[model samples]
Target: MSYEDAFAAMAAGTDEAVANALELFPSEIQTISIDGADHLLITPQNLDPGLANHLLIHVHGGAHVFFSPETALNSSLAAAHAVGARILSVRYPLAWKAKFPASRDRVVAVYRHLLQDYPANQLAFYGGSAGGGLILSSLQHLLAEGTDMPAAALLLSPWVDVSGTGDSYAVMSGHDPVIDYPVSLASAAREYAGTLPLTNPGPSPIYGPIESGLPRILLTSGTRDLFLSDVARLQRRLIDAKIPVELIIYEGMWHVFQTSTGLPESSTAWRDFARFLRTAWAID
Candidate 1:
C-alpha cells in the first residue's frame, strides 16, 4: 500500500486495513491528557520508573495528517527501545482537522508540563517524518517564548522543508520506497499549513533560525529517502550556526527505515541510535 493510501485508510477508520499494512511493537501503553490533547505514555514492559529523569518525548510521524498515539504505539515503542528511555509520546492535534500551530502549540504545552516533572537537561525529543519536523517546530516555539530547551533530539528522516524544495524530492523519486513527493508530501504540507505559507518558519522549521541555545540534535536519513536533502540542509545549517549536530546517512535505506526491525541495517541503526542517546544524555 502507498503512504497516501495508508493515510486515507487511517483517516477513514479502516482499522484492519491499516493495521495489516504496518508492523507494530509490544509496549505498555497508557493514555493520558495534557493541555486538553491526548498523549500516550508507551514504555518497554521492563522500563524502570526511576529512569523517568531520562525521558524521551516522541512525536509520531504520519505526514501530519494520519495516525494517532494508538495507531503509532508500536513505532513509539521502537524509539523507546532505541533510546532506552521511557516515552511520553505526543498525540498532537492532526492536520485536516486542526491546522498549523495547533500541533505545535500542544507539543510545546506538553513539553512544558514534562519539564516541570523532569529537568530540561534530562529530556529528549524523537520523531520521524512530519513528527520530526514538528520536533524542530516545537523547539522553535519554546525558544521564541524563552522556555528552557531540552538536552537533545533525534530526527528520523525529518521532513524539515515543507515547501518540498529539496533536491532529493526530485532526485530520489523512484528510489524512495515510501513518500511520493509533489503529490503525497506537498498535499500533506498544505493541509497542515492551512492558511499559513509553507515557508512560514514556525510551521516548516527548515526555514526557522538555527542558533545557539537549542538542544543538540542527531538526525538520520537514508540516501534513498526523499527527505535526505532536507535533513542534510538542516544539519549544515545547525553546524554553520555553531550548534552541536550529528547526521547519519544510511547507504540505501528509505525514510525512517529503522522501523523495519527485520532488516540487519535496521538493527545497526538502532544500536547507533542508542549510542547517540547515551552520549547525548551523558550516560555511560
Candidate 2:
C-alpha cells in the first residue's frame, strides 16, 4: 500500500479499538472545544469532585498516525479513575493529516487556552508512545517560548527519539513482537516528519534542550520495548541536567504494556503514577 493508503488503513483500524476501549473501561466522554479544536473530556468512574481542581491532559499515541482524541478514551478513562480527576485528551492533528509542528503547536495552543482558568500547577500531562513523544516535543516548544510549566508529566513508553537513533531499535528489532520497525514503522516516522528533518528536535525531542521549563517527569518503559533505549537516554540526560525525573522499567513488557491494565505490572505502573501525581500535586 502507498504511504497515504497505509496511514488510512491504520486509521481505519481505530474504530474497533475505540469500541473495545469503551467496553473495557466504561466512562463518560464529552466533546469540549478549546477555541475551535475539540478535545475529549473523560470523567471516569470513581471521579472525585474534590479533586476537580486538578486536571490531566492526555495525548494519545499511535505512531502519530492512529488514534484520535475520542479514540484514546481507553487510557483516558483508566487515568481519570486512577487519579480520581477528569482528563482532557488533546485532539491534536495526526501526522497523516498534518505534520511536524502542527501536532506540537495545537497542544501548545490548547494548553495556553486552558491556562486562563487553571494555574499551571493544577495541570499535568500524560501520553504513551507517539503521544508521549508529542508531549515532550510540545514542552520543548513551550520551553523555547518561555511558557509556564505544569506540575508533572507521565510518559509511558515514550518514543522520544523519532530519528530512530537508539540501541534498542537494532537490538529489539526481532524482540519486540508489537512494533516492527523495519516494516511500516519507519514510514510512519517519515509521514510524521514530512518536510522536517527527523532530527530537528521538533519531531525528535531527544535532541532538544529539556533542561529548563520542565516539571518533574515520570517515564516508563519495558525491556522488550523498542524505545527502551530512548527512555534510558532521556533519563540519563535529565539526571545530568539535575532535572527531577523518575524512570521505571518493567521486565518482559513491550511498548505501552501499561495499557493492558489487567497485568499486575500495569497495576504497579498506574499506582506508581498515582503516587507521582499525588506528590506533584501535593495531595496527601
Top model by TM-score, which number?
A: 2
TM-score for each model: 0.91, 0.94
Instruction: For candidate 2, write residues 158-247 as lDDT tens digits.
Output: 988778888899999988877967674788898899988888888999998979558899999999999999999999998888889999
Tell me the RMSD of model 1 versus the true structure: 3.1
Worst 10 residues of 1 by lDDT: 14-23
Pick the lDDT winner. 2
Task: Report the number of backbone clashes for model 2.
Answer: 0
Flag regions of model 1 displaced more than 4 Å.
1-8, 11-26, 48-50
Residue 208 in model 1: lDDT: 90
* Cα distance off (Å), candidate 1, residue 35: 0.8
How many Å off is the CA of 103 in candidate 2? Answer: 0.6
Each candidate's root-mean-square deviation in Å? 3.1, 1.8
